[model samples]
Target: MKLKIIAPIAAACLAAVPGAVAQADNTNFISRPLSLLDCLNIALRHNASILEAQRDLKASQGIVIQTRAVALPQLSVNGQYKDTERTAIESFGPPASSGGPAFSISPPVQNWNGDVQLVQAIYSGGRLAAAWQAAGVTRKQAAAQYDTAVAGALLDTRLAYYDVLLANQQITVQEASVTLLQKELEDQQNRYQAGTVPHFNVLRAEVALANEQPALIQARNNFRIAKNNLANLLGYNLPRDIWEDVPLNLSGSLDDRPCPVNLPDAIRQALAHRTELTALRETERLRQLNVVNARSGYKPDVSVFAGYGWKNSQFVDPGDLAYTLHGWNAGAQVSWDIFDGWLTRGKVVQAQALYKKSQISLADEARQIELQVRTAYSQFVEAGEVLDSQKKVQEEAEEALREAEARATAGTGTQLDVL
Candidate 1:
């Protein structure tokens, strides 16, 4: 029953590769061997940080709609109703003929007015247009930010994947060493039992095996911790191995694949493709639009409106029912902000300052990206050199092992040396 539930969730997370997860043992251990692509696809869908960035992109699109609305026409409805009583009508007359029969004036008993209006903004001193453009640029910036988030998530996942691979490789080496030590200990014990070697040889072999045991244990523990860290980054719980008490199965190797690009080319590509720089460029455009929007406050706005309305007649006979009147009206409007205690000027200054700040930020970010690219290139070179040295060391170790075996076979070297 539990597996039925887990199977669906696991499938959804790794939907790109259906049936990647399955029951591996009777104890319900989930054995899923995920490759690098599988991990990347899962992270793109399920990672929390990337999901938040996606929401931000959607929100920015909404802002574009809102900003564009300001440049479009608007429609509205208005209604009013009024009821007049006798005493209220009497208050409009002068003492009602000096109290003669307590006479009073008469007004309409009830009246209603309604209208449908449409207003079109012919001009908004360029503020509306600039704001719309700014909104578009803002959306671009949000998209770039989303790209940046995706890139960061993928890079971190790659690093974690490599870390797990390294740990797994270390475990393999440790296990091999432990097996070799066990064989050596068995050989030493046999020699001792046959009275051909001293007890000290057996003791030495035991100690060597004991010393190797701790390293093997530590290596296995490291592998488990690395796998757990990877599972956390993937935003999912990995099913454990019930048979060996192990972790989720991973697929891939740590093969050396060096980047061939040089330092200058790398820096060039980083400057061109880095999402942070793209987002900043969009922000700079948005800020420039803001400056235009602020400057528009100095000019007047113009609009046109047309409406059709109905109302009861304004004047009627005292005891007669009021007649209804309907009419159409249209007009043009212009509004000027002649004075506001330098409010427009203040806004202009603030917008300009922010624009300048955006430019500075863009330049600084570009420089930072260049520096990072150069540093990474240097590190790549250093790592390549170290890898070359390690390869040479491995070759020399293999040659020494062969020489030791030959010496032991010839009876000029001890068995421990070859082991």
Candidate 2:
């Protein structure tokens, strides 16, 4: 019994040791091999904002479909019923009093009728044509907006991803510094016991280690935050024990080069492709159509109508009693508004104002895009330059540290001097 308990406890302790060591190693290991394109691709599929924009685009497409349906014929069905009580009436004709007062038509000709009709708009003063154009433009606008959303989301993802990479790199630099200091501290302690170096040297090493600790901690925190952000974008709840190892790749200029296009060229591309500008232009066109429709109010409208009905003296006019039916009538209809109390003029003015406002908005959006593209391009290039500069600085720092160590080992350099 004693041996069995001891064996299980020893085994448990052994397993726990490896697990603890693994956890520590994993936290220190970080991956930095991802690129902007890879991140953008991931964001396109997973970013919530991009998904919402896509859904909105689909809804706009539905609207276009509804507008396109305007060309189809409209059909309607209608019915009516009537009841009457006998009443006498007089009739007047060419004889001044053609019939006695009580001898005229009675019961006011009771009737019932039902009919179904269809109307197809052959023309509408170019309103339908303009509307169709507007719908097409709206769809184009939606597509452009979706593209803009994708681009913006990709930019944000790249920024966050690189932030994490930079944090990890800084952490690595600090950790290496700490290792060197720890070795120096041990050496200083040994020398102090031997009376070869002052205790102050050992104290100095301790101070350096202490100073480096905070930076390392901060870097780790930043790394965790960055990983969390990326995980969120990928729609994951990052595990508490999550860790990654950096993948090494040879440096290539092709992967890091800036856009070669000039600012003017970029602006031109935006004007041609930006979704908001297209949407605004479509809105202006639609407003112009509204103006046309308002003006059309002054023009006359023409349509044809035809109907048939039956009348009988009997109360029940079933299908077999068709002999009591009358004939049918058909004619053209003409309606002219002639004039309203300035309502038409006010509508025209309102539409024109909206059209002018849309024009202004389009201009504003174009200028804004021009500014944004230029600014983003500048920032992108600047980040590359800064990264390159930091790389050189880091290399120089490492070389200097190596030289200092060699000189110190040769016994020609003091502890403070090497530091």
Candidate 3:
């Protein structure tokens, strides 16, 4: 019984041992080597910032549609009703109850009227046109903003992907170095036992191995963090995989691209393409319309109107009966704002100031775009140079290690010397 229980317990412990678990197949995580373009595509599809920008662009397009519809006819319904208990009237004849008949005698009167009417703006001096133009500008601006968002997301994905690749590469290098150092340590130990090498050789090898461990640990940490970062970039809740190689081949010299465009062209393109700038320009146009609308207060608004109505009055006498009267009226109406409180003038001034501010903002935004372009290009150039240098250095280190191993196998080098 004791033997049986001990065997079962041992089996259970072995079964509980930790091991690598298989991941779910639903995970579309990027595990294989991914190119920069692939990473950019992933970011564009999944990045939250890009999604938000897309939403904003959509909203802006909707606003454009709404503003454009301003040119169309507007329809509305209106109704009103009222009741009164007492009333007074003015009589041009004798007083009520004096010598006049009952019909002629003045009495409390009841009146009620109801009608449905429609009003539409026939014309405004270029206000609708300006508004529609502004909306179009806004739509264009939104498209530009979406482009900017895509570029930004792509750049970020590239940086994150490269970081992970670099970290993993460093981890591989450190692990290889650790293996070489371990083999050196073993060889030094054997040589010391044979009195062919000093004990310090073994100690040095061990120290190198220990130092490589710390570097390996740091690299693995960096790799994990980078993986998590990339997962976040892809809008994943968990990091199921990580691409561990630099996709860009860095085997060539870092040479600048020829005939780079100037800052003015960059700025011009940004002004022409940037959505925010275009949006501001549109806003400025809208402000101009606002100024026109404000100034419109000074002008007389003339309108033509026509309406028909019917009313019936009833009495209590047997001979009396309710009679219906129909009336139709048509006339021209005019509203002349001979004087106000300078409100229109104030609004016009405010609109002018806002428009001027928007112009300044547009100029500033152009300058900002120039700076962003310069910065992005500069970073691209620097990364290329650094990557090239690192690649060369890594290659040299690998070659040196290979040579060191070959010499060690030939028995012409001490263990420490080989390391």
For each of the candidates, give the backbone clash count: 0, 0, 1
Candidate 2 on 1-419: residue-level lDDT in tens? 11211111121121110111111122122232334444555567767879889899999999888876655555666666664543433333344265544442223344555655665554555556666776787787778778767655655555555556676677887888788888888888888999987889999988988888888888777777776776465334434664642222111112343334455666676678665677677777777777786676666665565555444433343323353655665666676677888887898888889888888888887777666776655655576689799889989988988888887778777887555
By TM-score, how accurate is candidate 1? 0.78
Tens-digit lDDT track for model 1 on 1-419? 21112111121222122334332222123256777676777677766778888898899899888888888889999999877875565435456467555644556767788999999988888988887787778888998999988877766665667678899899999998899778878977887898877899888988999999999999888888777666666666444543333456667677765446566766676777778889999989988988888888899999999999988875655344357788999999999999979999999999999999999999998887776666655666677799999999989978987888677557587867956
lDDT (tens digit, per residue) of candidate 3 on 119-168: 44444545565666767666766776677676566556655665666776
Models ranked on lDDT: 1, 2, 3
Runs off by more than 4 Å, candidate 2: 1-42, 68-72, 80-113, 122-126, 237-261, 304-331, 416-419
Give the CA lDDT, 0 to 100, for residue 22 in model 2. 12
For model 3, what is the error of residue 231's alpha carbon versus the real structure, in angstroms, after optimal superposition? 2.6
Worst 10 residues of 1 by lDDT: 2-11
Residue 105 deviation, candidate 1, in Å? 4.6
Angstrom error of the Cα, residue 396, model 2: value is 2.2
Best by lDDT: 1
Clashes of 3: 1
Cα shift from native, residue 419, model 3 (Å): 5.8
Candidate 3 lDDT score at position 376: 51
Model 2, residue pairs in steric clash: none
Give the Cα lDDT of each candidate: 0.74, 0.61, 0.60
